[model samples]
Target: MANIKIVLADTDDKYLMPLERKFIDGLEDKADLIVITDPDYLKEYFSEPQRVDILIINEELYDAELERHNIASVFILTEQELLNNNTGDAEANRIYKYTSVKEIYAEIIGKSSARSETLNTKEETKILMMYSPIGGIGKTTVSAALCEALAKYQKKVLLIGIDSLQTIGSVIPQLPFMESGTEKLLIEKSEYVYEAVKTKIINRTFDLLPPFHLSLPSLNIKGEDYINLINGIRDSKDYDYVIVDGATGFTEDLSRLMGVADHTIILAGQDKNAVYKLDCLLRNIDCSDNDRFVFVCNKYRNNRENFLANGYMTNFCRVSEYIELWTENSASEEGVLTNNRSIQKLALMFI
Candidate 1:
C-alpha cells in the first residue's frame, strides 16, 4: 500500500471508475492508481513498456508477454475461474469477472501486499520447496525432519503440503492439523484472511497450513493461486521459512514452485533408474541452473549416483535409517527427528 503502483485497464469507464474509487482513500493513499478504459490509449500506455507494480487487465486485452515487463504481478480478469482456452494458458493470475467490487479490490490489495511485504519485515519470506523426481522416496519425511530442525532453531516456519494423495495425515498422525473450509484462502478480504489464517494455522513443532482437501486439487491450481496462498500465510507473520511439500513429477504447478523457491530440495532414490531419471530431469528442466536447487538421493545405503545431467549429486541421501520412520505411527509429532545428521546444515542455511 505504501509504494505500489496500480493500473486498472479496461474498455469501460463505468467499471474502472468504481474500481478506482475503492482504492482512492484520501487518508494516507493506498497506491498510485491509473485508470484507462480506452483500448487505443491503453496500447499507447504500454507502448513504451512502463513500470507497473500491479496490472489489472481484461481478458481480451491480456497477453502472455506482459510478464516480461517491469511488473511484479498481473491479475487477468476472466469470465470464469477456469479458462477453456486450449491454445493459451493462464497467466500469473486469473480473477473471476463479475465478482463483487469488494472481492476484486480485496484480491488486488492482498496480492499487492504480498508483492510489497506490506505489514511484515523488509526481508522477503524465504520459500523453501521440497520436490522429488520420483515418488515414495521419503520426500515428505525429509520435509518433516527439516521443518522440525528449523522450528527447533527458533525460526518461524510454515509447512504446506500439496501431495494430492494426502501424506501429511499419515506422516504426522499424532499432531492435530489446522482445519479450514476455505479454497486456498481466497476469501473476500485480505484483512479477514490474515486473521483467519493465524487462527487456522496448526502449531506443534512448527506451523502447518493444510493443503486443499479436494482430490487432485493441485492439478487445477494456477501459479497465481500458489503465490497468493504463500504470501497470505507470510502476511500473517514474518515467517523465516515456508516449506512446500510439493507433488512428484513435472507439472506446471511443481515447475512454478521450483522456480519461485528460495531453495528447492529434490529427492531421488538410490538406484540406476533413479540416476537415469534424475539425470534426465536435470537435462530437460527449465528451472534456473543455479545453487538455489540441490539433489539428494533418499534411502542411501551406499553412494550410487554418478551424477545427474548437471554433473554430480548434491549429496548422498539423508540416510536410510529414516526409512523406519515412514510408518503411520512413527512420524508422531513428538517423535520427529529434530537432531538430524545433515538437516542441521539446512537449519544453519537461514542463520
Candidate 2:
C-alpha cells in the first residue's frame, strides 16, 4: 500500500480521469489517489472516518464546514481568475485550475514530505551524470530538459549541478542565487548533502540543488567528496532518479567522479579534437565497467562521414539550430529548452 492517501473532489468526470491516470503513472505506489466526481459522493467520502493526506477539491464543491474534518491539507482549485482568495482558512491553498499536472504534483510532494524524512522509504535512486568532453554542446540543456521530462513521467527527480562555470544559472534560471550547498556540505563533510541541498529546492518540474557556488578548484572537491555526496543521496533513497550535471570540458578528476555514476553521459561532436580528448580520457580512466558510459554527438549534421572518427562512434543527441549553444558561444543561448524535444530519447535511457 502507498504511504499516503490523496482525495480529489471535482464534478468533471473527464477531467478527473486523466488526472487519476497521471497520478498513477507518476507516483506509482507512493501515493494512493482517489477521484470523486459526484458532489454527494465527495461529501460522503470525507464524512467517513478515513485518513486522507491531501484533498484537492473544486472551489464550488468546497464547504467551510469540511474544515472540521481536520484534513491534513486542503487545496481549493479555482477555474476563474480570483485575486487574494486565500482570505479564509489560512491553511487552505488556492491554485489556478489550468496549471500542468506535473507542476501540481510537484507542489503536493514538496509540501507533503521533507527529503530527510523520506530516507529508507524509497527504492534505490539511479544516478546519471552528464558531462561534455568539449564545451558548448548542450550538456546543461540536455540535463535540465531530461530532469523535467523524468519528473513529468515519475514525479520524483533530483537535479544537482556542479557547474563551476556558472552556466547552469542561465540554463536553469529558476535556480535561487547561489546558496553554497557545496561549501556547506564539504565544510562539515556530512553525509546529509541530499537533505541539506533540498531545503532550498523550488517546486518546479523537478527539485534542483543550488549548484556549487565556488570554483571546484578553490574548494578542491576531490573524487572522494564526489563519491560520498552521490552515495549519500543513493543511500538516502528519496528520489527515483538523480541527475548530476557536469560543467565544461573534461579532466582526470571529472572522469574519476563520472565513474561514480550508475550511467555516464559524455557529450561530444563529430570533430577530431572531441574524439582525441574522449579517447585520452578513456585511456586514463578505469573502463572495466565500460557499459556505463553513453557518448553523445551533439549538434549532429547527419553526416555519415563525420560520424566515423578515430574508430569510435557517439550516440547523436542533437539539438536544433535555433539553440545558440550549438557553437562555442553558449553565453548567448537563453531559454533554448523552452520547446526542445530532442531530450526525450535521452530521458528514456534511464526511465
Global fold similarity of model 2 (TM-score): 0.57
Model 1, span 1-351: residue lDDT tens:
366678898887787777778777521354687898888888787778788878889989886666667887688888775532222443366777775665566556544554565422344678888887887777887887888867654467888887766667666765553354555454344445555566667786888866445544543545546566677766655687898988878777678767778778777665667777776677767434445766555566533433332345444222212122234454445545544545545455543
Question: Largest lDDT belongs to which candidate?
Answer: 2
Q: Candidate 2's error at 321, in angstroms?
A: 17
Model 2 regions more than 4 Å off: 1-121, 180-182, 249-252, 286-290, 303-305, 309-341
Clashes of each: 0, 0
What's the TM-score of each model vs. the native?
0.54, 0.57
User: Per-residue CA lDDT of candidate 2, range 1-351, in tens?
Assistant: 346777888998777777778778876777767888898887787686676677888989998878777577777888975544464776677767766565565555555554224312556789899887677777877787778767645448887777665567777665666565446575565777657755666656777766556676677765566567778878877778888887666666577677678888777666677666666666655444445776666666654445424343333222222222343243223343433334544565555
Top TM-score: which candidate number? 2
